[model samples]
Target chain A: MAEAQNDLKYLPLNDLHVELGGKMVPFAGYSMPVQYPMGVMKEHLHCRAQAGLFDVSHMGQVILRGCAYAELAEALEGIIPQDVVGLAEGRQRYGFFTEAEGGILDDLMFANRGDHIFMVVNAACKAEDLAHMRAMLPGIEVVEITDRALLALQGPQAEAVLAALMPATADMNFMDVAVMDWDGAELWISRSGYTGEDGFEISVPVAVAEAFARALLADARVAPIGLGARDSLRLEGGLCLYGHDIDTSTTPVEAGLAWAIQKVRRSGGAREGGFPGAVHILEQMTNGAPRKRVGLRPEGRAPMREGVELFASAEGGELIGHITSGGFGPTVEAPLAMGYVPAEMAAPGTVVYGELRGKRVAVTVTKLPFTPANFKR
Target chain B: MKYTEDHEWLSLDGDIVTVGITEHAATALGDVVFVELPEVGTMVSKGDEVAVIESVKAASDISAPLDGEIVEVNEAIVDAPSKVNEDPLGEAWFIKIKIDDVGAVNDYMDEDAYNDHIG
Candidate 1:
């Protein structure tokens, strides 16, 4: 057990989390806090009602640079289906790297940072994503950023909290990115987050990470939230957790992430079908994928968590799908889940059954997210 | 009160023994969201999983401590599972079992021994 724990890496704010009575657990090769003294339930509710500070430094932050912005955008567009060339400066968009078979390698958020492109990939897939980018786009310089710690300040009051620290942040809208100066530190700030709340993801130098996090926590409205609450929050937001909700086996269309693919990348547009798996992806776009991701609300209080098989009827029948992510939504105050089902069974009012233990429990196909997003658009 | 290695506590009065999870288990499980109790007339043996406890983080099973027949089950915790986190020792008792031997409770760890075991 000791040897296994020694294999895990510690975060820049490890000491701070321990000091705040955080319960450390291993996640994606890092020993991260799962919850604090406030617990997951309260931490989740706090992020929805006020503001929550999250340490997301374990995710990979990379800067891709080329001879020119257009050249870099074109090279990136070869891998992802999003219209990278059309992405304006200071703007970020959600995207995923696809395999030749239309499966998702990893989902990421990339921004056009004027001179270079800034990309953030999942913690678990960072190493593979970097290798894929380096191997595919040899002309572009893919530099991995290791000297920075990422923090997400999220919720309705996130704007007020961050703007108080850096007043320039007040003007930035959702999906906007900027390099703001804070006490001589270069803070790469983005007005976006995973919790479907109006928020900012700040990339600060590791040297000042703890101090900046302390500054945020000092505010009465902002509390340190752990990965436990983060999971429930994003789950309530109808967002995907890479390995669970999406992976190498699921396509963007089946995952219900078609919005990330702009019209220019689709069939009848200017720069259509240049990415990997574009043939299958565009075909699915024109027609439809057999299965689609949908929100699920279990009728009973018991949570129908991931891997619970879904059926068409309460009695014995063939399994239609299974839950990918699920838990008690603190904001919704009910057990909610997301899963894939046949397109015919994916409607909002459609009733499905989840097999729990040995019994069949009724689950309704509800529209996501369980709670409406509070993003400042 | 006696405790099992699985963090279940048992309190006996005559042949009937009330069973519930210890405070240590409750704290480790975080907030309880839902609970499924065994039927009142169900018979169970030692180590038989009789109840299910669902918390925000994960799901766990409550096993029967000794051979017995469930005489009563707590419906309050089934309705409002938060009681298991708020008052684990008192109101959160899951089931009452009429055991064959009253001396079975003595075989488990006492309060001090259980504290040391948890420590």
Candidate 2:
């Protein structure tokens, strides 16, 4: 049985979501809408086929400044493995805060906003991440943007829908950041999102956020999506959720997020092994981690949820791995999951078994993003 | 039809009993994707997990409310699981059981009581 949600915080769009018939649920200590009248299945497919609006204001937004570009970037690089100093203006890159032993603190995105760097960290890790940043960069100023609401307009038709109102939105490429105006209101728009589909994340003032969200939903192509669809979309896109996939104990190399780590930060590069966990991470880079994250496709419709034990064969076999994130991928129209397994058995096509109750269900190791990513690169 | 604390409903007719999850359970589960039914002739005690219902978001166990032997399982639900979400209290009944003791059925709540319990 689930406990009562008496202390859940409400989003700025909470009233609007309720009026729109969203089923509210407690997520990350917030009263977030998990789905609308269309349900998760339809809402997920809608985002893939057309456009959907998501309220992602729960994420922490911050601006770091009061220092030189190289200094600020170097300060951030001391904690993370990503090459922040090399990030060009108006460009965003995904990075993770790591521990001394190659464990991830949190995964986030930082964009070089020309004068200052703009960052967005996971909602669950916001407070801790802020404290960590302030402690690390004592001289640098960390400003939390609290009076803004973040909305994601995602899908194949996302561009067309936003471009009709703000024509400049269509010109932005993937990972590009810019400031646009809509009806006399300033919008910090970025061409990036968790969903693999081409989309834009718009940051608007809380005062006009309701009006802005309503305007987007009024468009025929845009439907108001909830957290349920958001999770499913990111799952199908092979994106990691903070606590479930990448956590304090999981390393970037083991979680398959090594791509987010730039070569300049690794061994044999200009800036070799300066960040936290660089010794262990670089070692893992050269000599691979014992276990690696991989995708799983169940033989049947049963979804192998988090913590489901995985084995090598139908009969008694050695415990190989455990599912971390899984669900019925509405877009993939099947049960898809991501889990950790021995490096040798992580290859695609390796057969595994999910222990459901007392039965062993067959699952095949497959490449991630069951549906191909449609990012406008 | 009577309901248990776990949200399963049972229909008693003579010594035979039919079991399924309530509408509230189906709604909470969102969309039903698959259902693993217990085999016929299996004897189950009260509170024993009999069936597994897999939804898009989660997988839940349906427990037996009264001691009984599985008489028949709903193959229609196995063919199309969404039927449980569509008509959970009616056509989507999970399994039929031959009740060993009729007195155990009294432990379940009636329709009005079950509705209030869910509320």
- Which candidate number has the best lDDT? 1
In model 1, residue pairs whose N, Cα or C atoms come closer than 3 Å (at least 3 residues apart or on different chains), thus clashing, are: none
Residue A284 Cα positional deviation in candidate 2, in Å, after optimal superposition: 1.1
Best model per TM-score? 1
lDDT (CA) per prediction = 0.94, 0.90
Q: By DockQ, who's the top model here?
A: 1
What ranges in model 1 sit over 4 Å off? none
Q: Candidate 1, residues A181-210: lDDT per residue as tens digits?
A: 988899999999999888999999999999
- Candidate 1 has a TM-score of 0.99
lDDT by residue for model 2 (A3-114), tens: 5566778899899999999998888788899899888888999999999999999999999999877788988888989999999998899999999889999989899887
> Candidate 2: deviation at residue A26, Å?
2.2
Fnat of each prediction?
0.95, 0.62
